[model samples]
Target: MPTILCQLEAVLRFLSNDPGDPNMQACRDGLRQAIAALKRHIQAGSSR
Candidate 1:
């Protein structure tokens, strides 16, 4: 969905920043969550 893509873009932007920064961990977590949610959405959509 558009919302998930937007969130993914935001996470990518955060990752594009300093990789050594402490906030990178938070960004990585967010990206993981977003990817998982996106996968769920896709699976649900496909099953319907």
Candidate 2:
């Protein structure tokens, strides 16, 4: 799970300098949401 999160974060960083096109912006937003969701999941698991 951590591996997946790391890879997603790496991709987000790589896209940081991309042109401000609509598609790229959407992709970045989606990645951010996915990373947030994964972090929430991990935290929830740890509290059990």
Candidate 3:
């Protein structure tokens, strides 16, 4: 199964190699939103 953390890492690696890419910031923001959503889920689970 694909995880947000894994995808974020891949995005970071790709961006680092191609910093001039036009879609960089948007891609990064989307991945960050995914990660944030996952974090919210984790926090909720732990609070239970």
Give the range of the ten consecutive residues with the poorest summed lDDT in model 1. 1-10
Between candidates 1 and 3, the lDDT winner = 1
lDDT of 1 by residue, 1-48 (tens): 567677787767768677787788777877877787887888898899
Which clashing pairs does model 3 show? Answer: none
lDDT for each candidate structure: 0.77, 0.91, 0.72
Off by over 4 Å in 2: none
Quick one: RMSD of model 1? 2.6
lDDT of 2 by residue, 1-48 (tens): 689999999999988788677899999999999999999999999999
lDDT rank, highest first?
2, 1, 3
Against the true structure, candidate 2 has what lDDT? 0.91
Clashes of each: 0, 0, 0
**Which is better, 1 or 3, measured by TM-score?**
3
- Where model 1 places Cα greater than 4 Å from the true spot, the runs are 1-20
lDDT of 3 at 27: 78
